[model samples]
Target chain A: MSKKLLLAASAAVLLNTSPALAASDADLAAIKADIQAMRAAYESKIEQLEQKVETLSAQQDQTAAKIATVEPAAGEQVATQRPATMQRNIKDSSFNPAIGVILNGKYNSFSENEGDVAGFAIGEEGERGTEGLSIDETELNFSASVDDKFRGSATIALAEHGGETEVEIEEVFIATTALPAGIEVKAGRFFSELGYLNSHHTHTDDFADRPLTNRAFLDGNYGDDGIQVSAVLPTPIYTEIGGGIFRGDDNPAGGAEGSDIGAWTAYGRVGGDIGDKTSWRVGLSTLQADDVSRDANEDEVNFSGDSDLYIADARAVYAPTGNNAEQEIIFQGEYFYRDEDGTYEDTGAATGAVDYDDGQSGWYAQSVYKFAPQWRAGARFSQLYAGDVPTGLVGSALDDEGHDPWAATAMVDWTNSEFSRLRAQYSREEVADGQEDNQFTLQYIMSLGAHGAHNY
Target chain B: MKKLSLMILTLGVLVASPSFAFAKTNIFACAPEWGALAQEIGGDKVDIYTASNANQDIHHMRAKPSLLAAMRKADLVICSGASLEIGWLPILLNKAGNNQVQEGGIGSVMASDYVPLLDVMQEKADRSMGHVHPEGNPHIHLDPNNILFLSKVIAERLSEIDASNSSAYQSNQVSFENSWTQAIAQWDNEGSHLKGQQVVVYHKSWTYLLNWLGMEAVASLEPKPGIPPNASHLKQVLQDIEGKNVKAILIAPFENEKGAKWLSEKANIPIIKLPFTVGGNAQSTDLKTMFDDTLQRLK
Candidate 1:
């Protein structure tokens, strides 16, 4: 009975255990299915996420491109705010070098009855024909700015001198404005500070022929190698002061050296607007040269012990309407003085010489009247006097002693523009020795392009 | 000498009067059109100067010393800045030595500033592209709408500089606008016929005008925007335009006409000469006349 009961119980237990195991298997299968479903859902979600990202990136690119297309340029807006006048006056600061060449050719024929001398290029005996065509001036100018503070200008002229091509330095100077009080410093070869005509170029002179004072005192367009400093003083009146130190030998004729053969000049000028329609200026200059050679002697002599020159100039211009281009009047005058200590050395009868202490003085006055927009008439008178000289000189010894020579000039000019001019002038020169000469000249000036400079 | 002294004294009195102490409102206009407009609006109250001369090629002017002197004393300065004056205007202003018209000064104004510019390059500007302003084309003065806006700006400036003359300045501006309106109406009437017209230009200078008139700029005489036309470019342009119904070939008086003329002759098209600026042609002395003459010439 116990065995039978135990077997029944075992069977019951087996049945219950098998049912439990079956239920556990079904639960495991359900759990596995749930895991597979979750895995598929996660994979699909990741794929969708990747597609969304790509679409967003493409939209961002499109937006960026549209932004670039719509934006206005920065430079254009900045330019629009500036004043028109200021904008019109703008300039490029970059260095753009320009090279230029100028060639001048002239031909003249005097009317019959005008006589010609050996050096003169016109006329036969008592009859003048065609004067040979001459290249009056040929020049090459180079000007540039190294930077904002430093600038340089140079001019070279090639002309026929003494039947040969001669090269001369017309202007070679470096100017700097990096100084105090509007001061400009110039160094190298440059023209001397003397007279109005002396400071102007041959092409810029009002008249074709130079004044007698310029010819006599300047001695063939005086220029020297030197250093110069000029400054415009900040004052109620327009004032300028300039000075320079030069090697005396650099003068056209070459200065003699024995004891410091150097030259120096200083000048001061004051100018101001007298009124709305008028302006005036007065200037004084002093020059000194040491150890100058005189009388063709091997030894040099310091005249005035060192020779002193004084020049005083005054100018007044009246423009009743304040438009000188239409109608105006101008008056100018200058006085010059030179003092020298006389010295002499005799070598023999073959080279005769005499010595005396003397001084020289000269003065000139000019008047100009403009009657029309482009027409002007002017007149000038100048005189020069030399103090007594020693006797026994080869050329006009007695006649030149303590005598005054004078010249009068009348001119008419027509200016087509600032760059072109036509002038006609007649002059009469009279010497103390009773020799009188008259000359008439007609001149035409044409500028090739836009190379004209401003007048100071 | 006595007569001269008396004359001098009389001249002195005139010059020393209190009325002569103040300088006139010195205005600098960049182009002849602006100059004429300034003169018309300012009347005798301001002295107007132009950077480009009537008889000169505006694009080729050299910035000279005399030009600087005029700018140095200016009370008000104006320019078409979109690079029109890029070649030399900056240098002239710096050297003019005037503090009143320098950058950031009240006296300075640029006409292009008030208007939107066109034809901007998306890439960097270089010489290979002929010569375009890196910023854009600055020739907005050709548009009448732009001029109207610019005139208002000028009136405001005039009033600021001379407060006492504000009423007069406003009145002048009103009259100028009225006249411009009348002129613009006439221009519209005439320009209506030119709509959709196909034209060839010598340079990009006419872009503003062409855009305003709704005319198509079929091509340019220049091979590229800034490059001069070569034989190959000209040939290509001619071939492209064959039987394309081009009405006119426009060229500015300042530009060399040899290439344009050659192209016109080869293409059998009418060559039209436009003034491009005030006082540029005999019929275009003032701003109103300039537009009238330009329209007439185009017709």
Candidate 2:
């Protein structure tokens, strides 16, 4: 009895020191006194409990002894006594916070026949063959809430960059449900309000290779440091409006040199059901980037005029069955235009061109069909046209007459489980200027625990 | 030409007659179990659709335009919400443009509301715990007791939505209850073979079902409750169960079984695959069949 009391007292003292308990000195002292008192009370109560346990133990022993004594005479029949049923209720709602992680790794081998034959030969010196599998994305995502209305999530990914593994913040944001207009606000580093592929993690991408438009236009893949405010509008139409202000250099490849450089983007989407089997959505987004230094040589180039980017996107998805894993056809298209005026001197002479704007537009139509529960086949056709390229030394290397790159992608993917997928794809990339590339990519994505929410 | 026009007009009138108009009650279920139950209970009176398919993980479903459309025209929407649909359900429901299925509306039914939940984070839940449901565990549908409780609630909701077929709904509920009760008894009897049997599971999703069967979940492959099994954690679990008599390693079809298979190989135990929900496995096509298959697997 005294031992139990001592154990309980020590447990209370340990609880007082725990960071999770969060007790002040005064509170700790009071709790200690209360625990002492509890121990004294339990000391007496322990006698009763000990007596009951002893009685039960004795009875159990007596039954065992009786069974032992009868077993010899009854032989094998008595030895076959059924074990007592142990009824346990496993389902209980308790506040138990669980932790989870997702580790995705892959190996890549670019075909020798792909890419420009001469360019490939030159690039081969830097290219490394497949020595072993590489960890494409290893993410640690954690989420918790202080209360019902407050929750936050942070995702960190350890990925290979520049031949070394680096840790990058994928998502670090806190969401508050207690909003005036059924709104949720998140502030952190996150993907921009851009296309579908931009918001999705690379591991969750449908195809092994990202589209040419996304790879060339969207800076360093996807994501940026920003704050986003989103809300569901209460209207007859299913509508959502969101806007964010992000640091200019959110992309890893094109980050802002100064912390003050920033950009703003706003997006609105309206969608509704056409019938039992069909649904559609129309979305429009406008992004504006402030005039800032284009590169480390900030003084070498200057913006001739304000540059604002506009993107208009719309998508329609149809499913014979409205299920996430069912066979469906998703048609999405977006138009992107960048108009900018800038002045720069490269040959000891300042040159300025008005309407030095470049309009790059691309749209893809894709269809995915589930041939079976484990297998799916999909195909997509995409085209990108870069119009009005400035022909000058000051213009970035992007200056060209124009290049219209079109691609046809075919993929076959298998879903072993909800958390695991293996996909193989063959893509033929062709440009009007006679640059053709045929690429084959195989990718495997495996998730360990609870999946994350779909990003915008 | 006049005869062809007359025939077309007659056919159009016949097809457009009000008596011949077919309007099936549209029911949208976010999970597969609800879809199965809705189909079973509504019979020919309703057309059902599930937002999550058999092959996909329901935890990370994206809200597609088609799902929103289905919700928009749906007369009733059933979901297993204890934050199970936190990722995309909100967007889908809001985009559905159907006020009836919005939050606090009669047409919206959260299956967890009727039953007790498990593994609710009493402490403030955070992202550190991979996607914890703030309300409570929404996987309660796996337990027969919860399903029994939810069936009555679903029947009552169905009656409320379609008053004209109230009696029919009630009758269907009675039949379903009777069959479910019988199935539960059979399961209990069959599961007696596994009473006190200790097993290791991959995820906490099987807690409710394991509890009902009186099975002991001695340990898990995951170090943290919801985390995926890593090599280090798998090593620890293997060491812990080295001398103990762990009859089987239980896993859900939706969970990654590679860890379980590796553990089974090292521990020399059979890997018993259990369905997380209806349609998750071939044997678990419906609620009743899910129970039967789960019990058989456990035994």
Candidate 3:
């Protein structure tokens, strides 16, 4: 404001001082005195303006300092907003873990009640449960890279058993990322890298339930605290070998009283693409547990010595569309051979424990055909190929007659989008004498968050 | 026996000779556009492989063993990061177990890191908002200006990865920049007519295009970021577009045409299925042609 007024005043002074304004000495002296007064007033005003400018600049610096100090408040703003409208500040920790939740619900109808297998000590999550609406495993998962050297993932599950809701820590693991020579070490409670289906979450499975081999051999997806170190060979073909030591907790491997490391697992896999449309992978895995104990369908079996399990899996996928994989065909199979050396006791009949050495095995094969953009049909056949137990048991559950327990299942699923899927499955089986094993299930899986991709 | 041993040794040497002589780096790109960009910068010093091709949704992908094999053999992995390859790349990296291309290594180049991104959500988005990237928009290669910055990053990395061919990569950077700058000028002049144009898009995929061409996306067919349009959103978009001077309805090739087709048939606006990236169409075989085709469609 002052500068503009000063400029106008100076202009007036200049206009009056032109050569055209010729006059006598008395007139010039009066003009000069007036000009001098005006000049003095302008000098005082300019000095005052400079002082005011400095004061304003200081005030602005104060305001900027306040803002700088309050910068941390911006972080609290992110969590304060609703999830749908929260702004993720890019500069706030350059890395964020992807969070995901998967919800699975199913309705089942069975011809007979098979929830309790008479002879075998059933594993946790052993049965498909009641014939009505039931919730399968619901998983909340988080994964991210912690640093240049490691990435981590944690999964917590809300599972239901006989109308009881239980919270379980399904997986918590940190994997080494910067290890040289194609080596990685993953440490935490995780699905053991033993078999094809043991490590995969139930949501990633094609079928609503686990296969017979996985259920029988690994006690329905074995999970425990372990450290696995895997290395991929530098050879051209894809070859990976990994070994782990786990605190035996779940079935097959009976952990020590205080979470002792009582189980060991190792696996090797070879995979490669055959052509533009076909790819295949083959893997071999083994698990050794100390002092495994469980009831095998009425035969109270306890293995005081080492129990060994061997598994082999092969999978092939053919996508007609190379990258546009709307339709595809997949063939997969798994085999398990378990040998246990222990004592057999029939607690139901109060039979004393006796020396026993037996081996059990199972196998399953499945084929899936994705016929259209949003639909797929698959069929699987699973059987307990071999079931040998200690003789003189109360129930003849593991006898040769009741052995060869097999089921054939067929399913069709329609995926409306990547986030949702509905599947219907039918299975016919007879695990024991005089039991009807016809079952039907309609299941829907809704994924609400970021889901990791399934492995081949 | 001696003769046979010598023959086998000779065969091994013959097979190993090429690797020692050239030692070209193998690059595995999650998307075809990145592969093409790598090819542009790396030239013969690198062998390029792509995980997703044209007309394939980069969001969901099957974990093919061959992709793992490619990743395993890759000396570098270039991808459109920001969780764009979240579905398949992690598993591939885990299975590949290759340290060179893991997240913090020099061999891992995320194009999103080099280019300034757009449409980064001002707020947190969840399933209710459909699928939203927390790290802003992951589609950075669509903007030609991003390519200039990314090319420099690529050249710098290629020089570091394959130091023997530093000059080749550096010269390529200069030549690529010259041609790219010229092409950008030509494209800008040609695209000047698109100024202040209003468009309808099926998704937020084309935001960079709209931002660059001075175009406004008044309405999107999708109700939310990733969700397909339902009845109300469609109806609202229809009413909102009324008297808006909308010029075109834009869509990418991979998007299903049902929604855009419905909107087009209802609104009488021409639908342009723009090839969004390299190999989007036969004419859009590379980066330059992609923009050329996109601008020509605008005209």
Candidate 4:
């Protein structure tokens, strides 16, 4: 007990010596005010030692040095050597955020007549820089617990397209804590937590690219500034329900304006494990959006008004050895149904507004098997097989409706370590009648610093 | 179709029933060691769910739905905190939505807090420090003394959460303490060769164990905590170990072996993989066996 007190006293003195802390007297006040209850527990003891802080910081160089000479700690927290250069701004060092970076690069080769599957528009999604080397995505992540009531995380994506670099704030969110009834509230620009794979970073995906249904309905992944609340029901089985309101800036339901939330989403999931070898989860989710100005097929056709998308996702895993790292087989699939009640405007040849009710749906299913250490193989099949559009359309609009488009993808990857992976994947794609596009890609994903655990 | 629907309805009733859920306390342990420890204390009264198994890095876990499923059902959670599980535990906790097992709750517990921590940070954390634990070294379970401390805390916590089984928990703790002390004594006598021994380690994970046994780790394979070995750092390690009487290069079974292999091949030192937790090796089926195997391998 005395040792603990003495260490705290010595540490307090060292902290008071920092010029930053000294100058920011109000910061200490805020800290004290923030922990009124905690301050009461230690205030008497700390007050008694206030007179001792000045001389101790100067004299505690040896003390810090002595502690530094001991064995270094493991993982992220090491209180190792601190040279003289680090003396000035040391107050908030203890509560600094964890930072991490992910570098994703891929090389792709695609046969030129790169056609599209009939009646399907894959959106801004396609092979990565077909026939060239490209840095697909570089992400900078920062996260920290913001007091006991909230935690904050932000991710910024950096990408270069056509010799120009672009930066996008992929996600920035603050999640609430201490909520009653097993509830959490997340606010900011974040991926909607409706589907299983929607919230995962692209770099963490099992394959190099998004699935066909995802690319179609979600325009890749639905990311928007929103407020989300989720609750876990008090029951024996694992069940969760969540809902969100978002500023509609995403695809499929793109372009909404003003203060009203453009998109509203709700979802429920139920899951559990069987014995020790098998686990499964199934979810049903829905999103409703009012697209103020929706353009597709190169602006020749535009949609406006209400649209709704419903999705169902299910996943299961069987680990024959009961150790995931050793041998595991995973099965995942998702289906989407979309209905749009909007007016389509054809600007090109037939210039008129047609009140239309269009319904489309797509699905994808994939399975991955880890047969040996450091080796995994997976295959996925996706299709944009259904859609109906109104008449009085011209140019790209007429060409956009019709038969089915489908794709099949397969990949094999070798992981050198937990932080690095190399994968080679192939895709057989058909856009329009016999417009076959053979695509191959080699991708590398390397993470540095405090990368979080990816969701399975 | 009607028969299948009827069968599904019956299954749902069984799943949602409280009697099935309350038969035993469900425990979620972030690491295998904690799972084994929970089993020792809880016995048949609890069902232990280990999030990470032997030879799997606990820092990060594959985002598996079973993880959330276990968390949702867990009556208690035990982990080596001090940010050892900082990467995955936070999101898992929030996503699981089980307020009973969130931080500061009665069911959420960290083993590092019950014991005196080693290598506690006194400096501010910064990127330049690599992966520095702001609290202290969280690998307190490696020290048998710390395990004794944790056993008491866990038993108390279990009793607090499951009052009906208080006396049983107490008895379990007593038996465990008695058995653990005896094992520690025997291992101490056998590990006398380890006293004043010097070794090279892949990471700083074994500091508590080394300190407890009066052994020393002369060098590390990593350039810094959480960072992999670099060429210059490996070169420096080679030069540093050129003349030292280091016994062997100790690497955790879960860690990448390339660095240790390189050091071993370059320095002509032997590399020994340590079963880091229960079930880490064929012989390490439990805590007692884990330490026995670790001690035997070190000797």
Best by TM-score: 3
Candidate 3 regions off by >4 Å?
Answer: A1-99, A116-121, A162-165, A255-261, A295-304, A323-325, A349-358, A369-377, A388-390, A412-417, A447-451, B1-22, B218-223, B228-249, B258-271
Against the true structure, candidate 3 reaches a TM-score of 0.80
Q: What are the per-model DockQ values?
A: 0.06, 0.12, 0.20, 0.20
lDDT of each: 0.63, 0.63, 0.75, 0.76
Residues A1-456, candidate 3: write the lDDT tens digits. 899999888887777776344546777888899999898889889888988998999998999888878864653243212123113212112435767789989999898876444344456665544578888778998887676567788999998866789999989999876675566789998888776788888887888777766776776778877787776665566777777777776677773556555777778888877765677889998887876655443244443555789999999887776543456788999988888777666565555675657777788999999886568999999887554555665453334445466778999998766678899999886665566688899999988656557567
Error (Å) of candidate 2 at residue A293 is 2.5
Per-residue alpha-carbon lDDT of model 4 for B1-299, expressed as tens digits?
24324433543454344533467888999998999989999998999989887866666455456677677678899999887776567767767656677666678777775667888877665545666676788888888877776777778788988999989988999999999999999989998878998889988889988998889999998777767676799899999988899889988877767778888999888998889899888999999999999999988
Q: Write the number of the candidate with greater TM-score, choosing between 1 and 4.
A: 4
lDDT (tens digit, per residue) of candidate 2 on A254-316: 336566435666676777666544667777766666553333122333333334566677666
The digit string of per-residue lDDT tens for model 1 on A231-312 reads: 5543445555666666665322245555443666677777655644566778887666655443221222112134556788
TM-score of chain A of each: 0.69, 0.67, 0.77, 0.76
TM-score of the second chain, each candidate in turn, equals 0.89, 0.88, 0.90, 0.91
- Tell me, per candidate, how large a share of the native contacts it keeps: 0.03, 0.14, 0.32, 0.24
> Which 10 residues in a row give candidate 2 chain B its minimum summed lDDT?
B13-22
Residue B167, model 3: lDDT of 98
* Model 4 lDDT tens row, A201-282: 8888889888877876776678888888776655556677777777877766678777766877778888877876787889
- B124-196: candidate 1 lDDT, tens digit per residue: 6544455566566787888887787678777777877777777878899889889888888889889998999
Q: What is the lDDT of residue B74 in candidate 1?
A: 69
